[model samples]
Target: MRAPLKLYLAGPDVFLPNAAAQAEAKCRLCAEFGMTGIAPFNPDLDMARPAAQLWQEIYADDLRMMRESDAILANLTPFRGASADAGTLVELGWFLGQGKPVFGYSNSAVSFAARSRAQPDDALPGTAIEDFGLADNLMIEGSLTLPLTLPPDGQCRPFDSLEIFQLCLEGIAGWGQGFNR
Candidate 1:
């Protein structure tokens, strides 16, 4: 049997519980496809550490996993805006900077300002799609591709939402195999 492909999942650990479920489903899908999957699971206790130390640990672990993986799957769901989790965005940049293939998923069918409860003091007052683009930066340079894995409108289903997960997995597997050549 062919070896499993290694996937690196990126998302917000602070606010997105759905990210964890997505990661798990992706891992399971990878296994089904005979590919290895790697995802970071930051528990509440991990968040209890000092901010600086916690960041240090998180970055280190994420970096290690990215370095060891073949590709990345990122959740571009906005935490505070129409883009993605800040940490998730940062890691997406890193992965792209490394020239790795990137796949992004998001429910950004709406504008950023529309999603915000209140404008930040530093808010630029612009659209989220314009700020973040339709896809992650790296994916544009032939390194990534943004595919819609969720409905454009309405609430997104949970990670245990098997149908969506399977769809995502199938896409990833196809992508991985395409790049494997």
Candidate 2:
């Protein structure tokens, strides 16, 4: 029998108040879909180390996990400012660079240009706003192996919402089936 696909779950969900719980929930959903979800925070680092050392260890460990995964499922919901989590984007790029399949979902219904523009016609100061009607940056959306389609109603939940997360998992599972063939 084939082993279940390992998916590196990348997102800003690690910053959520109940990150561990969220990870568990996502893992459970992955299991339901015949895949294993590896949340970025699943590793238990030694807290006794110095703060800087611990952070470095955590980053290294997460990268190791990403390298081992079969593919990546990233939550591209706008974070901090008007873009996806910078760290998550980096991970996604790393996985893409490795030639692995990439999938993403964004909770925001707004387009990237709409979110970045200060006003309807105003650009992001000096930078040009891409009017591609995509969720985030074109490089991100263009790299996705599966399209992120919103529900018919067009309403989306928060980053921690299991509903949206499940959608991402389903996409990964479907992609995996085709990928293995």
Candidate 3:
């Protein structure tokens, strides 16, 4: 039997209060879809260490996980800002750089342009937002050829919702023997 594909889970969910729970749930879904999910957290890492040293270790550790995975499943859901989490983008880019398969899902079906409302403290006021009809940035969707995965009702789901996440895994499973998993 073919081995299961190892998928690197990327997103800002690592910063969430329920991070471990979220990762466990995702891992369970991955197993059902015939793949292995590797979340970003490392329980062995000492959190009480110096801030700078700990952060560096985290960066190295996550990269190590990505190196071991066969593909990446990124949560493109927007966090505090308008676009997807910056850290997730970095992980996606890392997978893309290695020519590995990259898949993504977002809870928000709204275009990034629509979400890019100008605020008084905006860094670049009057800057035209790109409206290419994409869930996030052009570079992201342009490379992945991924359409926004939304619920059957075509409505936005919550950040932690796994409805679309399963859809993404199904899409990956639909790839069949291509993954050799």
Candidate 4:
């Protein structure tokens, strides 16, 4: 039998208090969808090191995992700021650079412009908010093969919502890519 597709699961969930739990849940979902989910973090990394060293090790490990994956499934929900997590974007870019298919989902139903405050008197003045009426930056939006979004009336979803993530899986399955279970 053929091997299942390996997807680099990119998102801001790694910084959450329940990072491991979220990863496990995502992996389980991926299995149900007949794919292998490769989350960015490696719990086996040695944490007993200097801050810089540990960070460097993490970066290297994440790159290695990304290289081993077939494609990326990114969570493009708004993070600490008004945009998706910067690190997740980097991972997506890495895959894109390699000409790998990229998929993503946003728990929010709101458009990027609607969520952004770009009026002249806006508290976050000066820089112009990307008002393209997209779920995220135009570049990211255009990169996705399937950018699943929540229902139009969906409320503010937490960073870890899996509703749209599952939608992404379904989209992949329906793509007729001949994945192996």
Whose lDDT is greatest here?
3
Superior candidate under TM-score, 1 versus 2: 2
Which 10 consecutive positions of candidate 1 have the poorest summed lDDT?
129-138
TM-score, structure 3 vs. true: 0.94
Q: List the residue pairs that clash in candidate 2.
A: none
Number of the top-ranking candidate, with TM-score as the measure: 3
lDDT of each: 0.61, 0.83, 0.85, 0.83
Q: Tens digit of lDDT per residue, candidate 1, span 57-164?
A: 977877888888877776665565534677776777777788777776654444444545244636565534223433323233244564656543556654334454
TM-score of each: 0.68, 0.90, 0.94, 0.89
Candidate 4 residue pairs that clash? none
Candidate structures ordered by TM-score, highest first = 3, 2, 4, 1
Q: What value does the lDDT take at residue 95 in candidate 1?
A: 78
Alpha carbon deviation, residue 19, candidate 4 (Å) = 0.6
lDDT of 2 by residue, 125-174 (tens): 57676888877788988888888644435676766777877877777776
Candidate 1 versus truth, CA RMSD in Å, comes to 4.6
Give the clashing pairs for model 1. 4-34, 4-35, 4-36, 5-35, 139-144
Question: Residue 150, candidate 1: how far off, in angstroms?
Answer: 3.8
lDDT of 3 by residue, 1-181 (tens): 8889898989988888899999999999999988999999777799999999999999999989999999889999988877889989888998988898888889887778888863243677778888887788899886563554656566899899989999988888887457553
Once fitted onto the true fold, the runs of candidate 1 whose alpha carbons sit more than 4 angstroms away are 13-25, 42-49, 111-122, 125-143, 146-148, 152-165
Off by over 4 Å in 2: 119-126, 149-152
lDDT of 3 at 154: 61
